[model samples]
Target: MSKHFLRPPGAVAEADFLGRCIRCGKCALACPYRAIRVAGLLDGLEIMGTPVILARKSPCYLCLKCVPVCPSGALESRVKKREQVRMGTARLNRKECLNWQGTFCRSCYDHCPLFNEAITMDGELRPVVNEKKCVGCGICEHVCPADPAAIIVTPRGAG
Candidate 1:
């Protein structure tokens, strides 16, 4: 059920996250982008008060500020760089993408923090995800021009 959402960077694993997180809002407080939120009752009882990011609402800027402040170590303090983050991996829906549909929009590729690294232009001038290079910061999803978003992020361990 939690597969629909994404945890902050440096999160160990879902099961371990739940066990280690103390429901403190330090992560949310440290997030200057306001991308992180504490799960509420409606989010489901098991994850209540835990941090989560709703990409469309706001996206992580890879600030790496939240991890160090997590008193419970739920967000690993060892994560100090964007490349080390394993928040999730972004996937694009070709059918919904303007570039894939022949309109030629590079919003996702242009805005990606990883630049030419994570999302690259293919031979057909369409955006392609270099999965291994993606840090799943959600910038691609946030920048998508498509109505329902042509791109989305799949959190690590979500499967």
Candidate 2:
């Protein structure tokens, strides 16, 4: 299965999401962060016109705007907290991380919306992820100075 792709916040399981989605572009238009995008022809017929978030391009800020605009119930409309939105999980590649090599960088932790809850510092000041607390929003991945990004957010099922 392709675990790398993610649905928006409050999205149902993949099979159900694909079935219920009506291919409308409301969700994408409603997003203030412009994090949501409609799948292109290259994405395949099953996902065309469906809203998708490409975290590396633009991370969802959990503004919850896209949720209510999903008329077909592809995305549940009532999420009240950042912790309730599970887009994916962030993983750290220690070998490529500047902090792991003692450069004193905390870009991922600083950019994380969950901050201390999802990412904490160890005694060495290296960022540690609390997987359960991470919503996989991808802000950490976007802000990393590393060429390949030391921190990567994987879609929920992908990991």
Candidate 3:
């Protein structure tokens, strides 16, 4: 336990970003993947109530277990990819970002399958997602450390 293994992944949503968090811990208990947690109040944050953090031990396979049962609208699903409704914009939480703090962790980069396009490692070594290249799979969001998640997915809006 020297290091924090899990973290909040990108591809989650703001409205769905713990917006409906009820502090019930039901999401924590329901997570079969064990990606979610209740770590009380963390630093650099003002969690309204019980703070549920997503520990990225294992990456999300897109099973979407915690989405349906959310008592609050905390985990609303948004459409992204028109092909199969599997893609959207992935947002990130710079406040909790270890990379943003000059750390050397690129878990999301390693986990993301999209290479040479979706996730680009900047000169600073931080993973930067290409919105156009991103498919909005929600895999990153599900594995994020932030309770509401730094990065989240949003529905693709028609222009």
Best by lDDT: 1
- Per-residue CA lDDT of model 2 for 79-128, tens digit only, reads 76778998888899999999998899988889888879999999989999
How far is 111's C-alpha from truth in model 2 (Å)? 1.2
Arranged by lDDT, best first: 1, 2, 3
Candidate 2 lDDT score relative to the true structure: 0.85
Candidate number with the higher TM-score (1 or 3): 1
- Best of the two (2, 3) by TM-score: 2
For model 3, state the Cα shift of residue 62 in Å: 7.5
TM-score of every candidate relative to the true structure: 0.96, 0.93, 0.44
RMSD values for the candidates in order, in angstroms, are 1.2, 1.8, 9.1
What's the candidate order when arranged by decreasing TM-score? 1, 2, 3
For model 3, state the Cα shift of residue 71 in Å.
29
Instruction: List candidate 1 segments past 4 Å from native.
Output: none
Which 10 residues in a row give candidate 2 its minimum summed lDDT? 1-10
lDDT of each: 0.91, 0.85, 0.53
Q: Residue-wise lDDT of candidate 3 within 1-159, one digit each (tens)? A: 222222222223434554556667665566676656655544324343433343234443444555555666555544222222233556666776667767666766776656546677888887687887766555666555555566665533311
What is the per-residue lDDT of model 1 for residues 41-144, given as tens digits with 9 covering 90 to 100? 98889999999998867989999899999999899988999999988999999999989998979999999999999999998889999999999889999989
Query: Candidate 2 clash total?
Result: 0
Determine which window of 10 residues in candidate 1 has minimal summed lDDT: 1-10
